[model samples]
Target: MKTTSQSRMRMVPTITNETIIALIGLYCLAVVMGYGRFLFTATLPDIMTQLTLSTTVAGWLASVNYIGYFIGALIAMFVPQRTTWQTLMLWTAMSVITTMMLAIPSLPIMLWYLVRLLAGIASGIAMILSSTLVIQSFSLERRALLSTLHYAGIGVGISASAILTWWLLSLDYHFDVIWLIAGLSSLPLLWLLLGIRPDNAADANPQPRSIHQTYINFKRSLYEAISGNGKAISLLSTSYVLAGFGYITSTTFLPVMATNQLADTYAGLQIWLVVGVSIIIFNPVWGILAKRIGEINTLIGLTLLQALGMFSPLWFAGALGLYANAIIVGMTFAGMVSMTLNIIKNMNPVYSNLLIGLATLAYALGQFIGPLVTVALAGDNDNFDAGLLAAGIGLLMGLGLLLWFRQLPQKSV
Candidate 1:
């Protein structure tokens, strides 16, 4: 009886290797991209009080972070092949260091900019490296599902920040303490992600190349990525820029908007929490939907949904509208990102990193531009109506780009 039972147990599938790698990737992203990169926005209101910052200054700081992100992506595109593990480790450490640096009370605004900027660079590199390695660990058939699970980390990080900030603030923790807590929370994730390696077949048996050869290879990949799929990449880049502008403007100001409304002291928290929850729930839904309906069609629908969500709060003007806006915008932003990257990956599997890096660069540019313009338009009155309208229009422009992508020939890429 014992032998028979053991045999049955052996037949069952336990946690697979791929599952472990995916979890590590997800955790790394949540820590680095979610906590390290975005926790700033979650805690911005509190930090603003401590720093005595103006809206315009705060917006410019945010833009500085995006600029850092763009530079990081540009660097990642040239990262010599087969060094994914080293890249991940270095950037993950930078993430931890930068997050903790923000915990310093009474720091100069310039220091804050530098810290956040470094965090953004860490996040950009970590994002592409983890995505590339984790996706490589899974089979082609299972890639989409695992990729969605990986992207869900962003939402998970956002939700975690919201809950933690709410609880800590309720307990009367100061801004410095909250930043320290967030930094401390990321420590364990580093150890957890230590085992995830790039198992890419192409990278498995890497041959050492001279510096010149490496430079040549990098140039070749960049040229191939652009020349091979110029039209598709061009369209994707424009869409990414619009998406970044639309989403960042909404997210950056939502908490401030909620506070100005004076609806409830915790109203902003609740709304941000809802946005995070919706993102977590919808990532997989859109992933599966893309599988069924095709990525192109899914992108078109989600972009339109996002545009509506961007403008909904201004149009409806109530708690109900705010919640609807949160759900729609949060749900669609990540889906649009996932679908867009998937399409880019499909366009040229070999140049996936180059393409994704380019897309991220475009995204960073949009994020950089959005806040500067929004803050300028929204001087002391806390009025973001004009900014929100512009965000919505940006999404509509993105929708037009997606339509254009669809109209191209089958060999467009």
Candidate 2:
């Protein structure tokens, strides 16, 4: 017979443990993604002004970062054993250091490019590790909800940085000051990592695979994914590539585009703030909707919404279009990411993490291509309308693929 005191103590530790895990995952994303990844967008205009960057060169910088992201994803897929929470901590710390390095006023353009590229790699690893470990912490009954909380960290980080950027800019702070502040703010998250017990998760199954077995398994999965009913899954994976291209174009350039169109430096940051808010608010809702309507259908609907979001700036003018773009795109993108991962996991539970890394690799490749196309089309005018149009078309093509996928026999994926 258990006393009430013992029961209370047990309950308290369990709840405390759960909360701590969620917080670690959330702040890891906030530091790695919000600061490391999207911070470039918030600071790009300033970097361009200070460095005298041409549109073409800016595109190159973005591409190089995504290239690092691709390499990180590849490593995560092939060598998942390295993705411990300690590794996540190491990468998160590196992101802070590299982000601050960009504040060096005398840093060459090439150095800026290199630092951002390294930051991207750290961000990519942190993103994969945080999502993987956080999801594994919850049981199947609670996994979807917990997954929503985990990914929502990206939005939280984005919103916090956007607000901070806006506030600092209003006070006439230099971009370097902004970077320093961002770096310092991440220091507290490090303490949370101290409490992380990777083996404490309810579902922590560290399956060790030899390199030879991993290679053979990879080959077998690849062959199956490309043949027979697996063809639908293959096609689905391909759609993620286009999704990456479509989303990254707007994400990379939204602030620059907004500033130019509105003739207000802060307008873009404000819109980005809206986007962050929408992502935080809607991701959990999207998770619920996925459970209700089915992941495939939810993905199709979200993709269609995102396509329209990409085209909104081109379709309408003034604040109406900008806000619509932020809200629609913000609400859909993170949800689509979560749903796609869920679909992939359901398709292959045994190899889900590797498959996710594979899907992310495809997406990273598309991201690598996106900025080059945008810059190429923008030329000297700096007008991004044509680039945005191309992104919309790419998303529509992905939507078409999803429609075709829907018609296929639902037996496999």
lDDT of each: 0.79, 0.79
- TM-score of predicted structure 1: 0.91
Which pairs clash in the backbone of model 2? none
Q: Write the per-residue lDDT of candidate 1 for residues 1-413, one digit (tens) a residue.
A: 75684455455443348777777777787788777767777778877786778888778788888888888787777764477666877898899888888778678887888888888898888877777767767898888888888888888887887888888888988667877888898887666555453334223446678989988988888887777578888998899999899888867777767766746877777778887898889999988998899889998999999898878878887676677777887798778878887788778777777777778888888888999889988867867878888999999999999899889887875
Residue-level lDDT of model 2, residues 239-266, one tens digit each, is 9899989988777888888888886769
Backbone-clash count (model 2) = 0
Against the hidden true structure, what lDDT does model 1 obtain?
A: 0.79
Model 2: runs farther than 4 Å from truth? 1-16, 81-83, 200-229
**RMSD, one per candidate, in order:** 6.1, 5.4
Listed per model in order, the count of residue pairs whose N, CA or C atoms clash below 3 Å is 0, 0
**TM-score, prediction 2:** 0.88
